[model samples]
Target: MFDWRELLLRNQPQASQTDDTTLKMLEEQLLDLLPPIVSALNAIANLPIEPTWFQSEIAQKFKLMLEGVEQQYLVAWNHVRNAQIQKLEEEYRIWYQAQLRSDKSLYRTYCQWQDLLIQQHAQGWFSWILLGLKEHPFPASELKKGHSFAPETELLLAEFFRCAKPLIQTDTYAVLKNFYSFQAIFTHQSPFLPQLVQGISNSSEKEISEKLEDNEFVEAAKIFWDILIVEN
Candidate 1:
């Protein structure tokens, strides 16, 4: 684990150091912290399975650590640069806000990537069922009210559902909203299918509402999956 406190302590100013030296030391410490934090996060992401809370928890910690480093830098700057305290604080505030936004954007991208992995796995199950290698490979409990399968199929379906349950929630509206927002920013980005985007644009709220009301969950899942892949 990366120890933010250890890094801070290691980089603390020496009593005999001049103001310029202290300022330079603080700047160097701030630069050094970024690489180690990024490397640790990358290692964490490569784990086969992460605890559900780990990413968010680490993100929060990283943010706090960066804020602490920035505060230390500002203190050094005040001692060495003779800048007005109010102006310096305001400048740091603006820079911190921008940095925080950048960090949030990176976290959101990580989450979106994780969702893509889950959707890809779900799509593999869809492909397996379509090939008749499995008959009804989703749980009866999760299916439409009248739907049922053989005992063996039910067993397989139950196991599969247990593994996929976390990713099974309906996200059509959310996916579409993300897709449009992303498209707005990256207008020239290649789409999975232009026709698909047009079709979604043409779809009405009532049609989507009916699909959810009628328990057409598989169709809804496919729509959400399509939007995810296309936007990716």
Candidate 2:
């Protein structure tokens, strides 16, 4: 039982007030979008087995999620981009004044602008963490790596798998393995189940620049569900 607080905070530098503000904003944005995203995922969980029905449900749900992720990332990207330009201007202004061997006010403003850039980068990391948590699965031991943020990522993925594992069926395995195991040599008659799921996950992030639809993540989600079904 690793302490999340200890793991998240140990050796981590304290964020300044400006950084804290930006992080809070990023956190809020993520929290706001989480409900709709989870709802879309839950809809995916309820998909039926019929080919036509499943395809319709998957398409609808995937389109919704993809649009949402793309929108959010684009907004964050613009904010960071703008902040970069402002940061450079402030730096140039500071350097020009530095030769005067005075101007404490200019120095203070420059530091504040630099902090803004730092804050934006932190938010970028937030975006990565949010999507990674949604798609990836990590074992508990992996979360507790000595002196690292690895634990936070692992914890989040572990929690996500716990929630999403209940929807899929263990019987889907044979089909899933065939669909995903493209390396099969003699499988002229490979099953299509894995291919279907892969296709759905692919649609979920088609427009998003970063790949949140990692096959390993999807596989881990399926495995987690299978193990749970077996245990019960």
Candidate 3:
């Protein structure tokens, strides 16, 4: 039988200062920690059946060692995992705020461009008529008007979209998408702003982002709850 205690002692590293680096190192170590025990178990299974007391005693010792190692590793790993998650959640919040600010700026710029175009180009009654057709508010061929505003506005929009593309492609976007998925969850009579604030506060922005981008929603609600409900 394999010396499980000896294997664990040989593989375990010396204690280090507590930090993300230490946690990461511990996580890596834990991943490989149990494989030797598994191999030993496999080896024992392959051996010819023996009802011998010595063989039974060895098997019992291996079981106890495996349990002890598992318990220790799990406790250590959970501590690291929670810390890493919290760090990620903080990062997500920052990213989310920046994203909101960027989107708001782009919308404001678009609205200003539209208002300026209407003021300069549309006459009294014509402007009213144009406004009435909200679905097609922008004049056809307005881009061809040779106006400086049109070119300037186009450039602004182009730059906005270019900068916004990377953000939309991220995991953070996924969390946002999920949050918005059920409109009724935060719609009229639901006190949207408070809920929104709470959700943002509780959310593990980075984790949600990753899960969303991967199109995985199975655990999304739980994470969302952690951020918005549990954490808050």
List the candidate 2 regions with Cα displacement exceeding 4 Å: 1-18, 42-46, 49-52, 56-65, 80-232
- Of the two candidates 1 and 3, the one with more favorable lDDT, higher being better, is 1
Residues 22-95, candidate 2: write the lDDT tens digits: 54544444445344334433333332212233434554654554455445443443444436534543543454
Q: What are the RMSD figures for all models against the true structure?
A: 17.1, 20.6, 27.2
Across residues 96-133, which tens digit of lDDT does each residue of candidate 1 receive?
Answer: 45654673644444544445445555555333223221
Looking at candidate 3, what is the lDDT of residue 157? 25
Q: Pick the candidate with the highest TM-score.
A: 1
Residue range 116-190, candidate 3, lDDT tens digits: 443432133233222322212233233223332243233322322222223445444432433333222322223
**Candidate 3: residue pairs that collide:** 171-209, 172-209, 202-227, 203-227
Task: Specify the highest-lDDT model's number.
Answer: 1
Q: After aligning candidate 1 to the native by TM-score, how far in Å is the CA of 41 from where it should be?
A: 2.9
Give the Cα error of residue 60 in candidate 3, in Å: 3.2
Give the alpha-carbon lDDT of every model. Answer: 0.43, 0.36, 0.40
